[model samples]
Target chain A: MTSILASAEELTGGVCCGASVAVPREASGCAMEAVRALVRRRVRDLTLIAVPQAGFQADLLIGAGCVRQVEAAAVTLGEHGSAPRFRAAVSAGTVEIRDSTCPAIHAGLQAAEKGVPFMPMRGILGSDLALHRDDWHTIENPYGENDPILLLPAITPDVSLFHAPRADREGNVWVGVNRELLTMAHASRETLVTVEAISDESLTSDVRLAAGTIPSLYVSAIAEAPRGAAPVGLPGYYDEDTSHLRRYAELAQTEEGFDRYLAEQVIAAPAPA
Target chain B: MSEAYRPEELLMSVVAGLLEGARHVAVGAISPIPAGGALLARERAAGRMRVSILGSERHTFFTDGGRELFDCAAQGRIDAFFLDGAQIDGSANINLVGIGSYPRSRVRFAGSFGSAYLYFLVPRVILVAHEHSRRTLVDRVDFVSAPGTSPPGVYRPGGPVALVTDRCVFGFDRAAGRFSLSSAHPGQSVGAIRDKTGFEFTLDDAVATTAVPGAAALALLRGSVREALQEAYPEFAEHVLGQAA
Candidate 1:
């Protein structure tokens, strides 16, 4: 029974080698290369957890028919425009939407980080977001007067995915100020990271770098993928490719156009296994 | 007339005026105009004012992820912030979620980013809506992303102080639970505002025309402020400030 119940690496995926399952990040490098790899692999029925916000990653996943459900704050393209594929899927009722706010998602992630059931947060008192979300609850503050605040349940995703500037051969990933990536790694069962480059030296060699580094203990896999956050841009590496983003946005507005975009750019040629 | 300025330029100046002596001003994501205004305010303060535009590397001071903004607001560190809405009511209730009912809606705007939390914590929330018609301004919103006022005993340090629209400016009175017309732009008329507005608001006995941006303000906006704004909003810098998009 113990043998039947236990498979050591099964829970962790052994190493991160899959296509479409988990949604990627936006701020802490969106893992665009990983996303493209997933698109190529044509993985399906994904339950993506985009911490607070997501953009091209979500849109691409949705457009590629990989996402079944999305738990996110919002999926937008910022100044470019609304997320065409996400909007279409939600409107058509093809994908399940679990609308969340930034703080709520953070609180939920924090709860998972703390190994707690839930965390109470201020605000969301009279907002429609609170009204719609059943997973979130309003509770009386135990310490103070009849104060009611929102309590967000812990969100422990099956896998955490992100792109970082660099990773060491030791599997330690350097995430600088992107603390949410660290939290995501801590809370999730497994973290799969793609990096611009795998450093020869250990990231923990320097004290400053070590302070912002997520140890290999939490990271399940580190894939060397240069320009991993293309179009979206890594904070230090490059600026967002707005021209490409604009082109994608324009092409993604219509179903035929989006399909064409996927055929021409995303899945035109399969990613290397 | 000392060479006309664009409505956006005038509006940005008005927003900067509202940020008169703000120690720390934060502009939310997707808000280029407000961000530009905040940059102008920082310029006016001669580096005294700190403006944090979300999603910008140079602007934000938060290193601890997204929660720092909320923490700062709750701790009263944030002096001013900007919130936009698909629909805003007379009571200052802003609806950013969507049109029609909840969960399911006819149209969904971008989900409430941090309005619900920041509206309760920040001291001054300046509402900016590009469209100032009956459709945008409502007697009541289809959804309340963040209520402008809270019941007594509720810990609310922040609320709507004023709203700037394409046509006019309206100052909100939190105690009175209503908005009062502050000023209209040069060509905009009180009758036009009243006709276009969906919600009922108090009209001041002497509603002045919104002041146009002077040569100095224009220079600052087109020069330094615009340059700084390019980091966060490149399109805005190009569109409004005539910088390369």
Candidate 2:
């Protein structure tokens, strides 16, 4: 089955480009709203990953009962956060929370961006962290000659949703100086963007500098909406949403706690007018 | 006699001004100038200045790396905190996530650790960074790591009454929700400060530089860090505590 046992190269797109992506209801819709709509449709099997720094609203997915998994490489406990007592995986449909100082999983997507079989990384060695490998495997570095590195099988999400500082209606994106966003957009086959403002004018108006974080070609759809990363700053617009920070800090720490938080703060909360 | 003035000196000097009298404080990572300065002040001010090192992950420790700092602060003991943002916008919001695109971008620097959560409640916060530019200082941030001014009476991580940058020292104008130029260091100018920010600031005619680390305070810190570290890591003390001077 091409869908079931496809080679690493064939599957996945955006951020983790080796998996299937769920097309949006419309090619162009508000990025976050589209993500919300996607969650509403696949509430049972989905994993959400985004930096909490901008308060990207992971809580919303958790609330819809869609976030079956959380993924971050360098995970920390809450004064006493331990690994989840329950074990979950891609097949099992559980969220794997990965929090590392450097973006490893994101780099996995970058490896996919280059269409490579694996991405080499630093860290994750000399620690017991490599112990939990029921699925993930380590390889003897072919390039480094005997040095071993971990290969996170590239991840292509069902949908890669992002919020940018600015984007064009045709799905062309302008990310200013922050370019790793390119790796993110490239890592997914289908990418969705919610922007601070949309300019029908070519982004190279010369008034604003054009540093490509994501090219229009990579983006599947683009929606212009202000404060899309609201409560989090809009790049050049506003700062984080304090209420969200305060509420999330006080409430979400674990899977269940964070899930409950999403329902009340994001899903049930009134949409911005 | 007054001491000779410079940027590195002023960086440490600001910490002296902010922590000379505070009983307890937290210092974040990357820039260690103020942190090193504050610890020095406590030693000289009759050893009355009790400061703790609080890193981004909410990891609190002493100069010797003991976890006690975290324990004490968690128990509601820390009084002042210093932090930095990835992106500092118009409202003084911070974004430290990877630069470029999202989910898959070129460089994923470091993720935000508790700064957002910490700033919300810490009584005193001091925002610090070496440079403020059109990129660093912005009208708004792509991500909100920590905010200079928060909603009124809204449990704002207290004590962040001042912002110390390489060019100038600043504080928030509660009514305007923007940073006001407090003082430029002895030699620096406001124009120099404005040049580095990604966003604009309200600058007044008089700006002040940070106060220098007086002899007495430096001497106090010099002696204290050594004596304490001598028992734990003697070799490290010789390097970090400045062996001869």
Best by TM-score: 1
What is candidate 2's local distance difference test score? 0.50
lDDT of 2 by residue, B1-245 (tens): 86443355456657667665677766643345655666565665675666554332222344211223333443556777777765666565666544454333233334445454445445666778666567676777654444556444333334356677766777766558778788776666667666666666676566545566566554544576445434323344466555333
Q: Evaluate model 1 with DockQ and give the value.
A: 0.61
Sliding window of 10 residues with minimal summed lDDT for model 1 chain A: A1-10
Quick one: how many clashes does candidate 2 have? 91
Instruction: Provide fnat values for all models in the order shown.
Output: 0.47, 0.02
- Model 2 chain A is weakest, by summed lDDT over 10 consecutive residues, at A1-10
lDDT of 1 by residue, B12-46 (tens): 99999999999999998878889888888889898
Give the TM-scores of the predictions, in the order they appear: 0.92, 0.45
Show model 1 residue runs off by greater than 4 Å.
Answer: A1-25, A271-273, B243-245
* Runs with alpha carbons beyond 4 Å of true place in candidate 2: A1-42, A51-56, A74-101, A134-137, A143-146, A204-208, A251-270, B1-245
Docking outcome class, model 1: medium
